[model samples]
Target chain A: MAGKAVPNATRRSERSHRAILDAALELVAEVGYPKLTIEAIAARAGVGKQTIYRWWPSKAAVLLDAFVALGERAAQEAEGPGSEAPYAFPDTGDLEADLKFVLRATVDELLSPTYDLPYRALAAEGIVNPEIAAEFVSRVMEPSVQLYVERLRAAQQAGQVAADLDPRVAVELVTGPVTARWLLRTLPLTHAYADAVVEMALRGLSPR
Target chain B: MAGKAVPNATRRSERSHRAILDAALELVAEVGYPKLTIEAIAARAGVGKQTIYRWWPSKAAVLLDAFVALGERAAQEAEGPGSEAPYAFPDTGDLEADLKFVLRATVDELLSPTYDLPYRALAAEGIVNPEIAAEFVSRVMEPSVQLYVERLRAAQQAGQVAADLDPRVAVELVTGPVTARWLLRTLPLTHAYADAVVEMALRGLSPR
Candidate 1:
């Protein structure tokens, strides 16, 4: 009877975990992070607050988990039908085309309503809370950023990128303008804008 | 008698305004923005809540004014001593050197404790509050960013930058990486990092 109950308990824990994440995401979207309380999350999830505390330490931790779950969903959607392979920059040997394709997808993600509210809230909280912000960066941002770094490294090996170029910094040059435009709302973040950034960062502004 | 009293009252109001801004800055630094309250600011400033409300609509507005005041002070200091000219990028005809010099100063400003705390609070708040964030982007970020746009436009006309490059987008490529590094704290924002960004940006990362 003890062995039989063990699997059932584990299943209950997993269901509770998903409910908490879903509740946290909905509450953050509706009320924003400052007002998002653990009690509210627990009530929304239909679990006791102790159930939440048993697994997560704080609201920030709960929100971070939600965001991670959301990102995983996005990646799966991007990968699409039967492509069990994880999402990566497609290197078709034409660097510009591959970059443009990836950037266009990024533009779509940034513009998507599903991702926008939570991402903005998470980003805002991270700015003020250094520890929470660092975790968000390490867990969510770095993994995707590493893909860019890897692509740049591949380009360098292929002699497409400059031998001296640091792949990490090079990736920033490509992605930075898009992010700045998105965050600052300085201009329209369109496919054309993405294409222009790729061209400028690749060929540079200097007339070579 | 009424005419003479008007200037005295105006002077008193101005004094109160300064005090309120000072109090707001101190309170925000000590308590963080989420914990900061208008009542607390009033108490710290030795003024009534009505006095703060008369001058600014909300706590965010008060903090915004404080930041504007700080920017003015930084600009004044940047112009002091050997800097005979007001705050403009030195057009030394070498774009790389001019960019490097300006970015190094930016690195110093972002890292300074005096500016970092309040700036982080305001930036974080702005991310969640679209209206406030838009005002900040327009009032604070744009004016400084325009300096870069102006410099790039001048460079473009002189055949230093690509003639077809949009000055606005070009400016982002230069400034975006620095801001991204600072905001995300993904890596050490150092003088070396600043220099590398300028190099990768100005001269495309692609093999020359």
Candidate 2:
């Protein structure tokens, strides 16, 4: 009986943890990040404020963890159940096709109503608040950007990309323009725009 | 006496207009765009709320005009008084040098403490609010981006850039990455970074 009670307690804790993260995402999407509070998340999750404070240092931490978890869940859904890896940027041995494919998927996600408000809220906060900016980049942005770096490195080895290029900066040639369009709303984010960006990046803007 | 009184009244109205713009800039920097109100701007500018409403339709309108006026003032200062044009993207007839020069100046302006908070406040608001986003993009962003468009077109005409490339999209290759770094804070905004972006954009990621 004593051993069974310990297992039950662990399951309950996990349930509460998941609930807190979900609640944080919901509230931020509904109210925006500036107004989000741990108290509100706790209430929405049916947990105590102390429960949140015990595990996370601030609302930003909770939101970051929630977003990370959301990404992992999204990855799992896109893949299949029991998938171990969170993501694998497609590698078709064709750099242009691979990048265009991934960027189109990114365009879809950015425009998705479910992710749009919450992501924008966090991004808006990060733009103004330095502490949130550092954490957002480290936890969310840097890791995703690393995927492009790895793919670009592979392309370089295959003689598809220039060996001299820094994969980190090279990734930005495709990403930066797409991001600028999305963030600034200068143009509609679409698959065609993504393909154009890939073409311009792979082929020099000056005559080759 | 009546004709002399007319000049005095026009001077007072000009003073009020300048004061309102200045107050809007200062308040937005201090309290951020979310908290800014016409009442507060009027109070700070030593004008009646009716006076503000008489000129501008909304707080966003006031702030937009203030930012535009600020840019005009800064451009005048940089170019000296009586400068006819607001901006001239450098065209030394060297595409790479010209782009790098302009991006470096952009980096400086983005980082300046005087403009940082106010710009961020507007950008942050623009991120989440579609109404603000459209207004901000058209009023502030479009005009500035046009400068890059004009410069790129000149480069293309001179046989420096590929004539086939769209200057609008091509400009994003340089500006997109810089704006991303500024908005996301993924890395430091620096002259060296700008130079690398210019090099990467001009020279394709693929081996020439």
For model 2, residues A163-187, the per-residue Cα lDDT tens digits are: 9888988988889998888887888
The model with the greatest lDDT is 2
Best by TM-score: 1
Quote each prediction's TM-score: 0.94, 0.90
Rate residue A177 of model 1 by lDDT.
82
**Weakest 10 consecutive residues of candidate 1 chain A by summed lDDT:** A80-89
- What local lDDT score does residue B152 receive in model 1, on the 0 to 100 scale? 86
Error of 1 at A30 (Å): 2.3
TM-score of chain B of each: 0.93, 0.90
- Measured against the native two-chain assembly using Cα atoms, what DockQ does each of the candidate structures obtain, in the order listed? 0.77, 0.70
